[model samples]
Target: MTSTVLTGISELWTLDPALDDPARPGDVADAQVLRYAAVVIEEGRIAWTGPAADAPAADAREDLGGRAVLPGWVDSHSHLVFDGDRAAEFEARMAGRSYSAGGIAVTTDATRAAADARLRDLVRDRIAEAVAGGTTCLETKTGYGLTVADELRAAQLLDALIAEGALDEATFLGAHLVPREFDGEDGRPGAAQYVDLVAGEMLAAVAEHVRWIDVFCEDGAFDPEQSAQVLRAGAAAGLGLRVHGHQLGRSGGVALAAALGAASVDHVNHLAAEDVEALAATAARPTAPGDRPGLLAVDAGPTVATVLPACDLSTRAPLAPARELLDAGAAVAIASNCNPGTSYTSAMSFCVTTAVLQMHLSLGEAVRAATRGGALALRRGDVGHLGVGARADLHVLDAPAAIHLAYRPGMPMTHRVWRHGQEQPLAPVPPTPTP
Candidate 1:
């Protein structure tokens, strides 16, 4: 394949893994920044990155007009396979009603009712929207389809997209909530039976299509013990563990995740000081490499505290304690948590801006959380940084510096994007309905 040399970059935030110092702990510092830089891309990998003056000759050369560049955003939590909008529920929440996990059933009905082709179209559109905004690597879950058949369909759809390189990670979240039918009233089986299905038959059917499994460990959903049951089942099936934890209260998701060696625990809106310490403690554990293809190392890595800023804002919930997590030596990631009931936009830039302006993270910290932090949460090392041999995923910005992401908040700053060495069309997608 022919190589391309990209020049005229005013600032390049390489975030090269090679520059990460073990002594600094969770700091992704400005030491990795390079000025007057250029990059060489060959065979969809970064062949070289350094001063523009020392750039070697290549098959093609393009100037970026002094714009800034960074690794494409890696969003590690989202729900894009579903087929409906929850604008009505959102409006209710904004009009003084509180958010609840019950809203998940509304989405489940619509997603289950959608035709296979329609659901595929909807998910593809959402992925395109995310890419247009510079999200190159994203992980989506299959929680909207509560039934065995519906969940299997969603998983298969995401698996196909992964095969085609249109998506990155797929997770099985069959324990999202107990569907209305399983409420256990008037002869219906209760949450216990539902949990059994998730840990047994449902998991058996979709386990081949997904790499990770997640449970909503909160009130009105699976309790701590039930969540543990499901996570253990997935682990037995050779899947990495993830958790939808502590979003609405002081749930036991953090303790459970750390104990089970889960890769990530998202929506941490209600963490306690002890919960922070538990996650930080996991950072010192040595990671074991995955023995199978298409799966993460299930037995290792820190339980990343994935803060969903957009979801917190839309639900009127307290922002996650991202600052404290980082300060305490715990790993942290920023994600959109894009879903129908709460967060509906796949804009990682907006999430990063919120992390900086509201969550008290510095620009570098926020960007790193949204990119490298996310990659670590998913246990994938190749896409988060622009190090040598990393995927050629570049997010070229309209501004000269990355700080403009927050300084010029809400402005359209994505000048261009390239994923895996090929340019992506930034066609405007319809504005995702907000809560």
Candidate 2:
């Protein structure tokens, strides 16, 4: 709870967009970008921020040597609790071949084949890479485990990581795909029965560990009806709902997600007119006292849209309709969608660049989408912005302006990172000994 003043920031992109008062929208688009700004951190929250000359005195001071300061990036969608690699499949897809939902089964096999120790290590390593890249908050899903035992194991792994203070959020994605062993050709069973088994048993077992449930609702994956069944069952089991919708094609997944009041409909690459209308309706919908929806309502929140640009970069897929979504009055968030086959990287910086360059998002829009918009997608009110009372999580940029993130893509711009008011130094690795 020590109060510290971080001075000598060349530029502070508060990401709050409110200069006069963070509660009210300010001229984030035209504000001087605050040269030589300083910030005060107290009790793991941003206490005050302004011109360096006006910085309040504190118990201690950490001069950043004129580095840039910005709120930490929040990655709201990722499948991080799995094992194995799909390099061959990725190479094939890069060589003019198409990707399908079935490719997920390959990773499923490998994840199920991995030992608990290995799986935990793999996830821990990925998360470390993300944190070093300035990702302060992230959401990871369990999709590779297609069976009851394997799914439970994935959940158990996530629980262990959480208990060990590794992962911040965990999701249950037991309906990621119809495993080959569950198909009729494999002499196992049918898809409907498999969905029921997952919804009834596997979901129940993992419910205690997961905060959300997701389904790959596509053509080759679970159909709309099947996906609905899984989501409904998960809701009945008290788990929040999310959907993998319209990444490959138009599958009515976005509309279905809005109907189910999902936390966020991810990969909305094929939204139709109805989908836009649905998003508008949801954003306009009012919530109750606690900002929770009424039981009978099925409205998506203010940030009704999420654009996963990394998936497009990896799979050669079309970018999400970011301009259309924003123009239609729907808030949008950006995520890495980090996975083995498609998005193998956990760099939110790359996602911001892709959003601005490929999806026509402005620099401010893309940054907001990566931070506050992501928090809205997750329905988390306290972790994305740099307002008072929010978590003291932030990233120090190596550049003087936030525009450098997109202006100079594919570069290491993160100078330092702080989580919960504590500065995290890079851990040293042992050097190789001479043979």
By lDDT, the best candidate is 1
**Clashes within 3 Å, all models in order:** 0, 0
Where in model 1 is the C-alpha error above 4 Å? 291-296, 430-435
Kindly list the per-residue Cα lDDT of model 1 for residues 1-435, writing each as its tens digit. 799999999999899978987776556656678899999999999999999999999999999999999999999999998877989899999999999999999999888888898888889989999999999999999999999999999999999999999999999999999998999999999999999999999999999999899999999999999999999999999899999999999889999999999999999889889999999998888766666442347668888999999999999999999999999999999999999988999999999999999999999889889988898899887888899988899999999999999999999989999998999999987743422
Q: How close is every model to the real structure, measured as TM-score?
A: 0.97, 0.91
Which number leads on TM-score? Answer: 1
lDDT of 1 at 64: 100
